[model samples]
Target: MKKRSLLFGLMATLVLSFASSAVADTKRVLILQSYHAEYPWVTDVNQGIRDALEEERFTEGDNLTLTTFYMDTKRHTDDAWKQAKAREALALIKSLSPDVIVASDDNAQSLVVRYLKDTSWPVVFTGVNADPRDYGFLDSLEAPGHNVTGCLERERFQGSIRLLKRVIPDASRIAVISDNGPTSRPILRRIKTQATESNLNITGIKAASSFEEWKQFVREMQTRADALVVVTYHVVTNEKGEEVPPGEVLRWTLENNRLPEVGFWKWAVEDGLLLSEAISGFQQGYHAGTLAAFILDGQAPREFAVTTPQRGERCINLSRAEALGIAIPRDLQTVTTLFKTQRVVK
Candidate 1:
């Protein structure tokens, strides 16, 4: 009887040790977002990352430790604020020492990734509009050769333009407008190289410096262009150098603009832009998350080539469509998600 009891106790101890070991093997991932938490882009991207991580059996608190930091650059576009946030983020990263990092958008890459390039920690970036070479974070897209690689987000301007032509057969000329910011610079560069409208002509690419300049551009485009391709106006400033509210900017544009506006994001279309086959923010995050998961599972970032997510969503604003008196075809209507009222974010 004593021998049997001794054997049972040893077996129980072994089982407990095995159980603890299995549960203690946790992977930590940190996500760095360029915008605020309340922003739709951040929300969608975070959700996509969560889903992708869960798909790879990395559930939070079970086997995964997931954390996020938002820079809130959109609301405050000054140079001082951006640099400060970048330093703060780097300190947080050092403190946490996460196994993998996912950086979203151009600012995060330019400001944050530049510091950690070719470092020990593996990094996956999403929604990066600028050419990777510009940041010098990796060797190349095909053969990254280093520990940083992920999604390169390019606007599907051709798709959006084609949809616009289908909607408005006579639309011929378009003018692109957005705030003068780091993100818009790449877009303008890409527009010169890739955005070719066979049936329509691109009038110009204008980056507004101030609220007055933004208003002037919108009013001036009424006579010079057929449609306006709006990128982003989050950083537009007022007379006193204060950043104007983006929601206010959108409301004014929706109320005053006569030409149809094409956007490259779902939140833009929902907020007031006439139409867009917007790039899928969700897919961007999912792709980045996938890369992080693979890195956590013993794969190096250099082993995988950089990729661009090709998914897009067709979004239409019903109120804007009705206001402009443009009719979306029956087939197109079936394919799109329409918003009845413009969502004005304050």
Candidate 2:
């Protein structure tokens, strides 16, 4: 009886040791974001990722370890600086040796994933504006076939245009404006194609890299076009050759522009754009986080198909509409999310 009790105690100790080892086996994930933490869009994406991880019971610093690196590419637009930052990120990745890497937005994919492509490490990306094929990350959307897969932020140009038509029935001509950046170029191309395919007259498509140029283009469009479609102005440089904050550009437009403005991002509606059929940044990150979880569970990234946003939100700025004397349709009010206050000023 004594011998049997001693054996039972040894067995219990071994079992407890194994359980502790299993609990201590934490999986590490690295999230590489192209923009800063304070940027609203990036913040939403991060929130989505965190929420999804929480749903999976992957608590950070517990069963899972998460490390995030923000390149702040929006503020630092110089090519040389971007390259240096990419090198720094790569070094950090080497040190971390994370099990999975999540690259968010165009710059992160362009700088980090592009370098680590076809490697043993798996990469999941979100908020990629351009075709993954354009960056040689995949053979086709249907089959990534290797280690990278995530979601694409399809530009909602046609949908936003249709909504704009509903808001401004008599408006015949429109101008599409965006910063002349790598990410914006692909979006502009799609917008132009959609404009050509639709019935609405596209007065012009303007890409402005500098703040002074952006203001000039807006002023020109005010006379030449009935409405303006804002894409993104996050990377536009100011008159002093410094990167201009997106809020500053939106505020300038709100104070100066006479025509109704529409956009593809929800933040634009909050920032005083008249209306938008906006893509949810949070959804993009959530889907990407889901994919990351799959990878963490030993599923290959290639096995999960690349996905696009399943839904778009129709957002209206009521205060801006009232200020412009444009009456919102009763049906639109029922279906759309309305914002009364300007989220950004000056």
Candidate 3:
């Protein structure tokens, strides 16, 4: 009986030790987004992260503990709110001490990761539209000498414009409009450069700060330009300086604007835009997630070079095409993804 009890005690001790060791060996990661989870970009990026992590055999609730934090700057773009959310993210980071942090978008890098540099923590950032050096994240794009490195977002401006011309066959003068936010500023510049290179005439460009301003801009552009290129309206605000919901912004724009609208995001086509050569949010997040996985497996962040993820879907909204009185060329149809009217503006 004594020997039996002793044997049982030994087995229990071994099991306890093994459990503790397993827990100690587990890797933890934290994904930080600048926007809410429901945002299509955020959702796509997160799915990419999950897929990459799984490819690397890091499954959450098994050998890895993954957590996510959303700053939600897209919904609440006030200056005070931005600071508060950054502080909130910082506090969470301090509490969790995750092995690696995956930050998505400009707000995450500019607001949160800016303060976390020169630390032991490895950070992988994705979907950064701004020049990364502007945030002081790296020594250089080619060789990031810090514990931070990841993916950059490249909008397929020329490709999308050429495709738009093919579909419309007469869209010479373009009017480009986006919100006057830090993230959109760089993209606006790039679009102008692309237009010049492609010899496409750009008649007007406006970055509206408020919904009223956006509406006015859209209305005026109808006469000034042949086609409308909608880049982003995430930070468009009300008179009270609060961000207008993105859905309202798009619906209002689509309902009122009758010109051919070209976008660079899948959500735009999914919403009601005429066409887009969309950047893949999934590729952005997947590359960042791959970097995070590598860092967790003892690879240094600096070893990876910063790069632009591959271009995503070339999409045409059939409903939008019908409304605009344009038929998608069958050859173009074969090359690009097609969407039915997801939302009826009328």
Candidate 4:
């Protein structure tokens, strides 16, 4: 009987120790994505998040648990439908109640702000371009007067322009395409300002309101412009009237029309763009993950300086370069962050 009592005590002690160890070894973090399926641009963002988490000394499995939720908007046809996805996403988020919620884009950020206005959970947004004041997410960018902050992908515009200038020197007439809705206006205005200051002759094309319209718009623009530039658009509707794949449209334009196109996301570079520049989505994700780790460590979101895409040039598709008969200058070559189709063997 004494031996059995000793065994019971030993077992209880071991169980308690194991439980304590388990609790200490696990950290839970929730990553909320605006889309479930992978698109090239944001996939890098997820990769960045993973890379950052992995580099951290205290990460999942060793003191962390990463829970990622990707909202799927492929079937939604309109903004209302997209918001419906947001609502559904909110329901899911309420259930998860994670330690942190990483908003992957403006859409996800909107949903989080609208749904969790009073919640104290930390939210780190990546790839958003909306004015914080407009969404009530913050008082201002200079001082994010709320519990939200991360990185924005908007500032990569200049890098894109510089690279395009390298690839298409004679590109005085550029064709700019965008969906005509909530987000496009600001992006267009910025691009327009840049074009005017840079002496870039740009012809802006608003994408069609419906999927059919978008298709026709692309067909029409094939012969109208020297090169193509895509900007954020929220007005173009999918069949479900909720969301349209802007990247896909950009891709189709490149593959079918055989023209040089440039995008802000490397994944959106497509095969035919003479050159493209974008902040690494994965890099953005890493910034977010690191910021999230800070919050997990009990630091306030506002304590960290709001970050933007690190300045760098990543280029792609030199095959597209050759096909377009555009000579890539050495100066631009010196700054390129990526080259998709060829190796710089020097």
Q: What is the C-alpha lDDT of each candidate?
A: 0.89, 0.87, 0.89, 0.67
Clashes of each: 0, 0, 0, 19
Q: Provide the TM-score for each candidate, comma-separated.
A: 0.94, 0.91, 0.95, 0.82
| lDDT string, candidate 1, 1-346, tens digits | 9999999999999999988997668888999999999999899999999999999999998899999999999988888999999999999899988999999998998899988987888899999988886888889899898889899888888888888888887888888889998888888777766657354577777889798988988898898898999998888899998889988888888888989999999999988899998988899989888888999999999988888988899888888989999888889889888888878578
For model 3, how does the per-residue alpha-carbon lDDT over 61-101 read when each residue is reduced to its tens digit?
88899999999888787789999999999999999999999
Whole-model lDDT, model 2: 0.87
How high is the lDDT of residue 101 in model 4? 76
- When summed lDDT is taken over every stretch of 10 residues in candidate 4, the lowest stretch is 337-346
Local accuracy of candidate 4 as per-residue lDDT tens digits, 1-346: 9999999999999999999998865666777777654555557777778778677665666777777776654334356868777777777667766777778876677666555654767778887666655667665677776687778767466677766666666666777777765445667777878888877777656645676676676667677777778664334676776555554654455556555777665654443355667657777788888888778778777776566767545666667667666667767667665454632110
Model 3 residue 269 lDDT score:
89
Best by TM-score: 3
Lowest lDDT 10-mer window, candidate 2? 191-200
Instruction: Return the TM-score for candidate 2, rounded to 2 decimals.
Output: 0.91
Q: By the lDDT metric, which is better: model 2 or model 4? A: 2
Q: After superposition, how far is residue 217 of candidate 2 from its true place, in Å?
A: 1.7
Off by over 4 Å in 4: 1-11, 181-183, 210-226, 232-252, 255-259, 329-346
Better of 1 and 4 by TM-score: 1
Winner of 2 and 3 under lDDT: 3
Among residues 3 or more apart in sequence or in different chains, the pairs in candidate 2 whose N, CA or C atoms overlap within 3 Å are none
State the lDDT at 22 in candidate 2.
69
State in Å the error of residue 62, model 2. Answer: 3.8
